[model samples]
Target chain A: MAKRFSAEKYVAGILAGDRVMLSRAITLVESKLHSDHELAQEVISQVLPHAGNSVRIGITGVPGVGKSTFIEAFGIYLIQQQQKKLAVLAIDPTSQRSGGSILGDKTRMDTLATNPQAFIRPSPAGKSLGGVTRSTRESIILCEAAGFDTIFVETVGVGQSETAVHAMVDFFLLLMLAGAGDELQGIKRGIMEMADAIAITKADGSNKDKAKVARAEYQNALHLYPRAASGWLPHVSTCSALQQQTGLNTIWQTISEYLQLTRSNGYFEQKRRDQNLQWMYEAIRQGLEEHFYNHQQVKAQLPDVAAQVKEGKKSAFAAASELLGLV
Target chain B: MAKRFSAEKYVAGILAGDRVMLSRAITLVESKLHSDHELAQEVISQVLPHAGNSVRIGITGVPGVGKSTFIEAFGIYLIQQQQKKLAVLAIDPTSQRSGGSILGDKTRMDTLATNPQAFIRPSPAGKSLGGVTRSTRESIILCEAAGFDTIFVETVGVGQSETAVHAMVDFFLLLMLAGAGDELQGIKRGIMEMADAIAITKADGSNKDKAKVARAEYQNALHLYPRAASGWLPHVSTCSALQQQTGLNTIWQTISEYLQLTRSNGYFEQKRRDQNLQWMYEAIRQGLEEHFYNHQQVKAQLPDVAAQVKEGKKSAFAAASELLGLV
Candidate 1:
């Protein structure tokens, strides 16, 4: 085990753009140990100034949607084009019985993990919407500090909770299987409503025709949705990740165009500014909730109050009022 | 508009076992209009004493999992054998802005809706978990008051966000498609961990053999999870909603077995008792948060503080402390 550096040193490393130190700092922040949490916040406080320089993109899809493969191919394309250094943060929020993580991102992203120009961090410890790690926002800051101009937040899209990830990122991409389920039913309104762009994955030789049809259907569906503030229409496209076809450049080009359109119209900067506020407020709210519920007295009284209300001996309103000392 | 009845009259109708009044009161409560909300809460208060009488079951499955078809068939089975007055609060949480519900249950449960002994209410409006109406908890009380012996909450298997429905019900049954995706990756861990029983839906005709294999796989996978308090081994079974198969009966049997085992061991009553208190506390907490955040000053100031924290001009901890008057 590496001798853990102090918070100040870790913060200094991140600001100094040391990739190795930035990785270590993210790990420290993601640790559940109480002492590590305190230090994590300290490191975050010091590195916060260097954030907001990277474009945070959130990618989500159902299982077997080729998310890992797509990111790998996409990351390679960006590097080849010398666009900018990239960082990938994959968060698995579920914990085992012992509170340990089963960090599985590295195994999934075989190609991306080996890229020297990319910084890939897999965190399974944090709890946030979309399985995003608690330290992800801070980690993005560190990545930006370390000169990564683009950050990709990849989420396991089994749940309808993708909105959580959508809120944090600059652009939201949803991947889908070609001709999976009823073409209309395959895509949900909630997911479609949030998507800035939709991509039909696994569009190889055999699936190309189906992918094209799916793309057309998605395009029609996108029209039903209120136009996103990006002013640029949400594009529905197809890509074959296995073939390394590298259609990601076009995707990035679309994103750049969307950003330009939205920013010129005062939506892009406004949305980012709005999101940062939401992020901070939610963080504070969650912290306070954790404290309130964890209080021993509250926990002890909870069961009894629940029973009374359930039995009709007490009204939910009165019970709530009394419990909160409003009466 | 119908003249609003006194809360006492609503409670009286509930205790007298009138399903129409039971549903009407629930509708009144779930309405967002201020007057309806006030009357609804009053009605709830009056009927509080008559609740806690029925078996509450939660059913959830993926799209095309034949959830509506199965619920209809199973509901008929329960009425035939037990001759029990059964009520279903089938929740469709999302509705398109065009005011149409594409996947409506009332349309699918055609036969069950007309059954004299069965009362099926479809799609209450609210933004929240799919399995639950915003007022589903309150509706359960109304159903219990209305002399229903079994109340089923039917929800499509969406994702983890639907866990709110699980928190309120007595038994949770997860309905899965036979070949939707890799079974291991399709249903999230959090959902599988919380389920009381797993049932593979669409197990009729061509899918029968595959459903069997899926059930067996689920049974094997379920073994890895910790036992629920019911002391019932999480049962994995298959059913075809179209075949009017004994699937629903088997589901009921499993639930009964769970209730018997847990009730005998004092777990069932204890858990219900605990739930009552949890509801009261959660209500109060949400109420307070809503009220506090509703303050115009607080809402306006939040964005400014957020920007400061994001830019590193102010620390989140410090900003939160000052905002909440903790400093």
Candidate 2:
């Protein structure tokens, strides 16, 4: 019965900048309460015409890396300047055993929660990529429909292997702490090679000196990375969320300069096209994974074949072919 | 046809402890050249009863972390003790981009390759976890059939996700370098928590002091982790692979003690059983993933739904159900 709601009505509300409706639409989409996914797609179709104006930023770091604090401070800065309507979407990577998230970022970012100009949503990172939630890219569309010009997609740092988030965001910012010896060793060259910007968080008080040293190291490393397709050199800087001022102006200025250069050269459009292709590929891969695991015939035979394979009585290839009836 | 290889003949040669025929059989199994995986499995089944006598050890660390150097020194130590049968397998994670490896371990471990008692195989990771070749587990079984009592699975420590090697090995060792500041920050909690032993590599010369300090830091961190199922504490030590004699004895001693304690208490048998179960689970997951992605109908419709979701024209969940025929 709930699935019968008009998708067009919700999408119209979203396009008209109704926040409550947008929130409800995203909830319906993210929920596994039932497969209301198809109906939600109809609503999305009505809302697509209004998206694409927002700058999508992806933020990631390990737990307790002050991701929430950073987002709250950054969100407030954008709202205060009345530069753009801002939204913060944090995807928490949960423990597989407990199926519960380690942190609920909204609870930690109280100031941002109360600000009308800022919309903050915390999502459990289900079975999707490490950085973005299942409905994140969709949620971004809704936010854009509701007139949000900047969207922050924050993820619990997954160490290396974060290509998923990189594929979806316009700017990928890596947050780190100072005194992390030989910056190159702490985070591998592969990860550093992907960052558009690296910000040393907790740059206040005793960590200030360490932050300065880290900044210098990162600056040197950035020089080693090939120039981004956007034709802008990756930048590194320090920021202190506690003081509510940590060279955010410099960050904004740098980003603006990057966007200006890329947009003028048509690189921004090409990037969006590339992102669309990437998302399509991930969607197909994920969709197939869901199908194969959920098939009735395969599910029934899995346990028996698994037992044989586990006991070393059968090989994996033979077992796999049998499971799919290719034998 | 290549699928008509004689399993009886291969089994006869293997039980007689003929390493030449055993190596040939393994080569047939690892070959993707023949479109038949069935013939290889048949040969493997005949040899299965003679397997499981080897102590499977997994060693991993980041690239440039001296993994090959350590394996060379360790493998040589086993051979000198007249344990002449030592097998080394290094799984390359970069194989997907580069069609096949150059198999360069000989250059890296010149001494060990010259030892008659030792056999080393460098395998491409392909799409497998830990960048391990698909046949690695099977290869270990074949190595045991050839009378090799100690098998080492070495993988490039790309990130925290290389836990696949741990699932198949009797003992899991993580290699680290010293002076990795805040020592805690340098080690990812995911990988560190799973390690059974933490060995600080490159511990000679100026690096020795840093190694000692890192050992102390890791010792404190190890205390926080629960004891192993065998009631053994995770060990922290230092090693210099280039020194050849630095820490190989400690590693062997630790594994021996673990096996002794667990064997008497029946924990070792149970642990092996659990590993079998884990392997089955991984197989099922991988099989299902392949099925879903390879399904013709599912592939054809997924992109349209994805595009709709991207444009905010459809909710991902709703679109998925419709494509899956649930709606």
Candidate 3:
């Protein structure tokens, strides 16, 4: 077991931008131990005032989309050109099953890993999506309290994690490879619509023209979509992380414009407020479901009841009523 | 109070294809009274085996997309050309507040409404989305048991109801007005990806060319989407509900082909089973929330606690934990 710290020490250390304390606090938040949960919540509550100052961005793409390379380039750009402290975190629910995670090897983002202004945290292995999401959200707060001005929450684009990441971030960026058929990219349906911006990666050398064509096609497709509630149209651009690092500036410009529009219109603050309430309700739901499903009576009867419902031998509502009664 | 019948009588009448019995059973399912709830469950259980016989389709579009006209034409086509009995239902959770529903007026589909082979039901007024969805799902079973071979669940394209409709149907059809800017159609983002087919309405006379162009554009856009789990690529076509009623055949053909493909691939039955389990979990979630929110302590503390959460004065998970403790 990891050493425990008093809530006051953790709070003070996080407020004073101590990376070690921030990382320890995040580990506590991710812990499943009952005692750690109580201490983590106490630490979180104390540091709550210091959080919410950072711009949180969610970046996603299918495997082979060069996510690590893009993040490295973007992270370097933010620290050097933009002069922003950056926190990089990931949410990979499948990591537990796959036994490997996107950020498991810090070598993939070696420069970013070594940068003093940048902090990178791999996703907590062996946790369910809910557990990972909850911890990641708390980690963002911890990072913000540690004086990070920007947060990037990364997740694979092919699963349900994107929706969770989308809920917690201010901006959503999708990375895609040029020349690959969009259908062959393995992105889940509806993910493209959730993107605030699309970046065609590796847009250099021989791939430049194909990236340009893909960018125009995506722009047109985005045009056909309804305007987001933010009143900002989604932008599409091309960037090469390896050689030119060409389109990172454009992506940043789009995010800047989006933030300007939404903040000016008060949507940014309004959305954050809504997200807080939504998260509270979501937590309540998770708690209730956990309690009910863990009940001895419910666990014993669920399989049979579920089978009946699945076979159309019972109505879903009726079956649900029966299970709820058992608890 | 509406009259109540024995479960056996309701089951017998429904299996014998009595429309009046089906309507009465639907009324019972929609009732808010405690006694009615018990009786409704009993009736539903009895009719459960007789259900799942129909081809369920979800049809949606913005108000000006001529959804009612399209449904009227499509309903007539199914009953006449396909020799199938049809039931048309709407899910408008906003109906109570708006004081109007899509199918509230039978005259909207006068010919189809007057036909003995077609049954048209308006959205249940003054209920939550959950309530309406539950009753509509139950009603679909009742209609199927009453010998209706085709069920159309309709909803306004711009709200959360379409997702509910999509969950309960085998095929999802999106209606769009030709020549109108797609963004101006008020379609919610992420909805187009839910569709299995898109039909461009008002395609007769002067609108034909524009409809053809829109169809091509949508078809092209859809091509960029990942194929559905059913291995079906969504189809796009043009139809005229008023004059020639052109392309209705193509729409039906698409649904037929989709059914054939999904059924052969086992996705059709698997999806139904998955949907059943999903609905059961959804119902349990609703039940849990209703119980928790209605608790006296929770009701009294919610307003202030929610305000704190919204203002970021407290962490969402912490607030949820406190509230859950209160209950």
Which one is best on DockQ? 3
**Interface RMSD, one decimal, each candidate:** 7.9, 7.0, 2.3
| lDDT (Cα, 0-100) at B214 in candidate 1 | 87
Candidate 1: which docking quality band? incorrect
TM-score of each: 0.61, 0.75, 0.92
Q: Which parts of model 1 are misplaced by more than 4 Å?
A: A1-4, A94-104, A125-132, A180-189, A242-246, A303-327, B1-46, B52-281, B287-318, B321-327
Q: What lDDT score is found at residue B187 in candidate 1?
A: 50
In candidate 2 chain B, what residue range of length 10 has the lowest lDDT sum?
B180-189
Q: Please give me the DockQ of candidate 1 compared with the native complex.
A: 0.17
Q: Quick one: ranking by TM-score, best first?
A: 3, 2, 1
Score each candidate by Cα lDDT. 0.71, 0.71, 0.88
lDDT per residue as tens, model 3, B179-261: 75664347775788899999988888898899899999889878887667999999998888665345888899999999999
Instruction: Place model 3 in a CAPRI quality band.
Output: medium
In model 1, which residue pairs have backbone atoms overlapping below 3 Å?
A: A305-B277, A306-B276, A306-B277, B61-B157
Alpha carbon deviation, residue A34, candidate 3 (Å):
3.6
lDDT of 3 by residue, A169-266 (tens): 99999998877566334777578889999999888889889999999988987888767899999999999866634578888889999999999999
- Which digits, one per residue and each the tens of the lDDT, describe model 1 over residues B45-134? 777777788888888876666677777788888898878878887565555322324334567788878887887776554464432344
True contacts kept of 2: 0.20
